[model samples]
Target chain A: MTKTLAIDCMGGDYGPSVIIPAAISALQQHSDLKIYLVGPQQELQQHLKQSPDFGNRLHIQDACEVIGMSEKPSTALRRKPNSSMRKSLELVRDGHADACVSSGNTGALMALATVLLGTLPGIERPAITAELPNRKGTVTNMLDLGANIDASAEQLTSFAIMGHVFSQLADDVEHPRVALLNIGEEAVKGRDSIKLASDILSNQSQIDYVGYIEANQIYDGNVDVIVCDGFTGNNVLKACEGITRFLYDQLKTEFTSNWWSKAVSAMVWPILRRFQRRINPDQYNGASLLGLREIVIKSHGSADSKATLFAINKAITEIERQVPQAIQDQVAQLLLNTDNEDEE
Target chain B: MTKTLAIDCMGGDYGPSVIIPAAISALQQHSDLKIYLVGPQQELQQHLKQSPDFGNRLHIQDACEVIGMSEKPSTALRRKPNSSMRKSLELVRDGHADACVSSGNTGALMALATVLLGTLPGIERPAITAELPNRKGTVTNMLDLGANIDASAEQLTSFAIMGHVFSQLADDVEHPRVALLNIGEEAVKGRDSIKLASDILSNQSQIDYVGYIEANQIYDGNVDVIVCDGFTGNNVLKACEGITRFLYDQLKTEFTSNWWSKAVSAMVWPILRRFQRRINPDQYNGASLLGLREIVIKSHGSADSKATLFAINKAITEIERQVPQAIQDQVAQLLLNTDNEDEE
Candidate 1:
């Protein structure tokens, strides 16, 4: 089946400078891929003039309004009737695109996706899932990284189901081990919400629900899916980003200090590059808003061409693997089970 | 006034290898300082043999028990009657030592200190405060970084007061601006507990409460004192540590890759060392458990001699500044007002 992706061309810091080239590269690499670029037609067309196949495979949807990064998410959505993010979601809603990719305001994208594309039948909230690189060359899928801050127990259960299906479909993990993030490892430890969620998850047979996992165990590759409320997950993700930036700055200062150290630095250059490639944020770009009827990948706003390409690739993989369908199937099973329990 | 610090000799990873030398270094540097070393007599005495005036400045208490790093904190006090951590707290309780310092399990130390020295007259759980390095040369004081996992409104109010006093004593801020860590800057953005705590903090006359501060503002240097529940605080701190470690590993790999980069690295060695010193975890080694009657500093379990010495210096400073006394005065005033209001 041919896969078509709706791109928010005007989103992100570098805008078309990064996204345009990336879309072209993605289209060139993936022969089955067709991109419907959504943004200001004039600017997008001007940028597309440089590409050879701009008219052949690329389609444009005029969306003049843009959501500024600093704009209030709710107010922007209400005020800007023809924003690119909204139009992209509309394309997915109308079956013109299999997936939507944007590096725009995350809150705005989430709101637009929920309103336009709508969530899966039994899903309460759409969770954003990011794949983090583990030591064993496998990625650990973490969910609700910031889609919903205040989540109910039922929402958390939905996140686990969506996270499991995403991992299985996109990452190809069969019966993925799903673990809830808690302060402590023991099943008894954590707040009432976490404890109650654990009990609920343990009883659900559809998911391979493992016991509680501590924050420290996140990098150990012990579980395939780690789930938490948006507040905790966002904090953890930001903290990880902040620390990485801090350490990189510190190391840059260290290596450039003296002559002898610099000489030694040259000898180990290639190995270092290999390691950097392994952990680069660009390699892990594109967090998907799982549980939505259509696949929507949120790329980093500051991403360059490489990172944008990674996000586009992620969108392709989601469409090819039928991630949204898998999530819908799981949610249907959960709803049926809930109904059965109520009857009993 | 003489300042005496109770040192838990058998607490840390390397124990005496680091603690003994650090204590000696601190003593030599601060002439007014006196140390009450609590551990087994034989090992401490043998280690003290290297210092000629050890007997004159150092007093040894034969506790004969040590708390293991991995042991459950709740069981440590009752299981081992003469555990070094318990004995250290007792010294402070009996007024034999003005302050106590340990590099053992933090949970155990907090439990023992709460049970032994007790909280300030009307205070709830004592808070753990640590000074984190911000973007500027100055530091920001953060509290409840992992003392009580679940904090009530009253406990949060106490934390705010204690955190203010801690910054005044350590960071030397006369009227520190205290802020609650919340999901957003708005008062209505967080959980009910956070909203109640924010209300209480804003109304308090003693503390210079500056309203809600979001996680993004944490490194912005706007607020001098930040307070949150232990679970959230712990997650933030650990996430920071994890990210720092991740970046360090990534950068080291990046800088050591090639000859030209190594040459540049050699020239920048001194500058890099200065940067390392600025963000060194060792420089900010000690954490104070506030709201306790006696001052207690918790050092990292894997701390080296330099980190241990930093902890000792922190203990001596707290003792000299009479941190406990300041907290007592603040709590007393708060209690008086509360009692009067209740009576009315």
Candidate 2:
């Protein structure tokens, strides 16, 4: 199926140079895929000089302004209307693109996307959901990763429903088991909001609500979907990233410490590389801003060309799967069923 | 100075068997330490059979009831008055012991400790603070790890103050740099309560407030103390644990995949083991329940004798340092200073 994506060219660390190539590479990978490279025209054109032509499948959309990584969301929304991030979202909103992929300022991207593309029905706010590589070699989808810091019980329930649909579609996990992220596995554990959300999910007929799971059990892969408020989810994700890097650095230090260790490290380097590739954060670069009216994939700001390609491909996949549409249907059905249960 | 510790022998996974041996080891390590072994008389005696007696140093306090791992905190408080967990705390409450060490149910332990010993002056609730091994080979003390689910701005400021005092006393770091855990380092990022806490912390002349820090910077060791609400802190801590195990397991699987890999792994096993010990959760086992009237160390529920000894030693360190008195003094002074500032 033919799908179009608006690439935020003036986003991330490398900006146009990294994103333009990734978009071009993505276009090559998917023959039916089209991308609107949104950025400052002259700079983007200069960076795109090395890229091979792909006819009308690739085109440039001028966005004079660029959002700084540390730019406040409200400031970005008010001041930077012509930002690459905003332009990318505008493409999706105006039906020029099926989805938007940005490795830009997350706050700016979220704010601009929410303002431009709006949200799906019954979802008060969109959630940022991402796949974390787990023990089972499959991905565990966790949601509300810094979108809404203090999600109410209803919002948490929405996240669970959206996460369930996402896992089913994105990972092709049938009957994806959903669990609430808490300090303890017991029902009595966690804050009142979490407990209320648990109660709401327990009575949920749509999702495979498997009760509360601790953060330690996240990578165990016993459950497919892990739901938490944005604050907890964001902290957990970043902490995992932090520890992964710390351990890897420690391993590298150990391998290079002495002559004997260095020699053995050379022999085991291939095996280690293979293992590293499996757990590489680049593979999981794209985080979907779920429950949005149109799809928006937020790539890591430091993502290289390869990682940006992954994010672009994520947009393609979402477009193909119609993730937003699936979420809308699922949420509507779930809410209707819930209303019926409440009435009964 | 002889310091007395009340050990909840019926706590944790291994219970009396693990706790008794660990207590024995702790006694051997600390010559000036006295222990009150709180548990069932017959079981405690059986576990102590192989241990060489220290005359009048180790006394068994008979508490027949044991708090179940899954027992509700309120239920445990109400029904299990004779529980070993409660008895250990009671020893502290009655001034029989300077500190209490439990590897039992955390919720019950916190509830019982809070109810029996009460909070320190100018403190509403106690926080669970533990040291995480950071990249700099030193530890970062993070607080409110699942003790208080929803901390108010005032409560968070109190946590920062408590954590500051703890780092000074326990970690022996002068002018410890403190930071509020947030999704972003920006002043506008995170929830309102976090922002309010930041505002409160910035004006405080008592401690070195280093502004906001993301969770990914947690292991950088740039910040001495990281303070957050219990929910976020707990999730981050657990997620770090989860990822560490996940990476190690992946490494193990890779190293044991083939004969060549296995042979290489054999040569590198010693190095790997050394690296593992550095990041082992067992080494950082004891989490201090700070802001309480007395010292209480909650060890991991699954901690073996080695880890349990770490917890016991932690209690001894707290007793020697007089952590509670220090926190009480610090909190009182900080409150008085804040009141003076308000008047000004």
Candidate 3:
């Protein structure tokens, strides 16, 4: 089936320079994919002219306004009615596109998506679920990366339900293993909020709750889904980025220090490249807004052309799998089974 | 001047096996250091028998009860009156030891330290502060790594004040640059509590507040002290550990996969070892329970002998610098200023 995507070309840091090329790369990879590039017409025209792949399948939708990277979500929502981010989300809401991809202000993107596409039944707040390569070469789907801060126990359980559905659709995992992010793996550890969420998750037959997983164990790839409140999820995601950059920077400095070390570094460069490729987080650049009524992928705002391509491909995969429908079905089933679970 | 340290030899994953040897090594390194080993006398004697550095300075303080790793802080406080953890904290409170180092349940350590030593004047709650390697070959001190959850806006500013004092005293950093850990560097980014804390930090003349810092920039080492509430602190600390281990593991596996790679690895092994030593987080172990009346360092529960020695050194350094007294003075000064800081 043909899949149409709405790309927010003006949203990311690099604007048309990086995103347009990424859209071109996506079209080349998925021959049947159609993209509606939403941005300023002249700017999008210049980039499209540079690419040989522009055709009728590649439609251009001009948007007059944009949401700045540092703009407040509330302000953007009230002010920028013609923003590329809003226009792209509108495409998905109006059934013109199967999915939407944006590299825009995270808060604005989330606010606009929630207002336009609404949310699946039983999901009070939408979440941002992103994948990162783990030790076992399998990806871990961690959710609520920045969507909702101080999430309640019921909301955490809802996140688990959505994450479990994602693992099944994206990774084809049976009885997808799930775990809550905590300070310690022990039950008596973390704060009261985490303890409450544990009770809810433990009783859910639909989610294979594998107990708590610590931050150090996140990349172990033992669990398919890791759920947490937005504060924790956002910090964990950024901390990983900080450490990865430090290691690579240190290794580079070590290699180029002296002539003797440089000779050895040249010899080992290929092996190091292989190591880098295996652990590069850029390949996992896109995150789907999981509990939304329609699929919307948020690309890293600072992503390069290659990373942006990976995010677009993520959207293609979600469209093919009908991820929104799958999540809605699972959540409806969970809500239908009336269980007066303990009041958290 | 001589410094006395109380070691909870019964605590940690390896118990006396790692702690006793580490104490002996610390004694050898610091001739003026005295260590009171708190544990069952017979077991501590058996471990001490292997170390040749034991002398009059190495005294054993017997504590019959042991706090299990899984024991709850509150329960252990009520049940185990003679626990090694309690005894170590008592030694500091009674002035028998200038500082205490424990590798027990973090919650138990924090609880016992707060109850026995009490908070310094103007300090509401105690916090755990530790360091991690940064890209600049220096370390970043992050605090409240699980000691205090849901910290108020005023409490966050107080954490910054304590961390700033620590940076100056421990690292000899003059006018130490401080930053509030947030999701973004922008002033309007992060939640209400964080924004409130930022306002307090910015207006304070005593602190060199560098504004907000994101997680991905933690290793950049631009700021000396990074402050946050316990939840974000714990998650960020652990996330760094997870990513570091993953990268190192991947690099090792890549270097040893085949004969050709092994040959290249052998040539670069020396350089890799040098790089590892420079960035090894083990050297940064030993978290001080700041804001308390007495100095207490929490060693990593799974620390090996070498890591424990480093932690002991940390305690010794704090004792020499009179960290508790320094914090007490600064906090009292801040309180005397009579600012109506917005109620959290």
The number of the candidate with the highest DockQ is: 2
Q: For residues A1-344, write the lDDT of model 1, one tens digit per residue.
A: 78999999888998888999999999889888889989999999898887976445789999999987656668656999899888998999999999999998777888889988888898878988999876545889998888887677788888888888878888889989999887656554456777787877877577899978766567667799999888778767765665555455555555555786566556545645665676677889999999888899999887999999999999988887788887788779866775575456
Candidates 2 and 3: which is better by lDDT?
2
**Candidate 2: which pairs clash?**
none
> Cα lDDT for residue A143, model 3?
92
**TM-score of candidate 1 relative to the true fold:** 0.81
| Per-residue alpha-carbon lDDT of candidate 2 for residues B1-344, written as tens digits (9 for 90 to 100) | 88999999988888988888899999998899899999999989998888998999999999999998888999899997799999999999999999999989998999999999999989998999999888887888999898988889899999999999899898888999999999988887888999999998888688899999999999999999999998889888988888889899999999899999998888888998999998899999999999899999999989999999999889888888888998899889988887787677
Question: Candidate 3: which docking quality band?
Answer: medium
Candidate 3: regions farther than 4 A off: A338-344, B338-344
Interface RMSDs of the predictions, in order, are 4.7, 1.0, 1.2
TM-score of chain A of each: 0.95, 0.98, 0.97
lDDT for every model?
Answer: 0.80, 0.90, 0.87
Predicted candidate 3 versus true structure: per-residue lDDT over B79-159, tens digit per residue: 999999999999888889999999998988888888998999888989899987787777788888989867898899889
Give the TM-score ranking, best first: 2, 3, 1
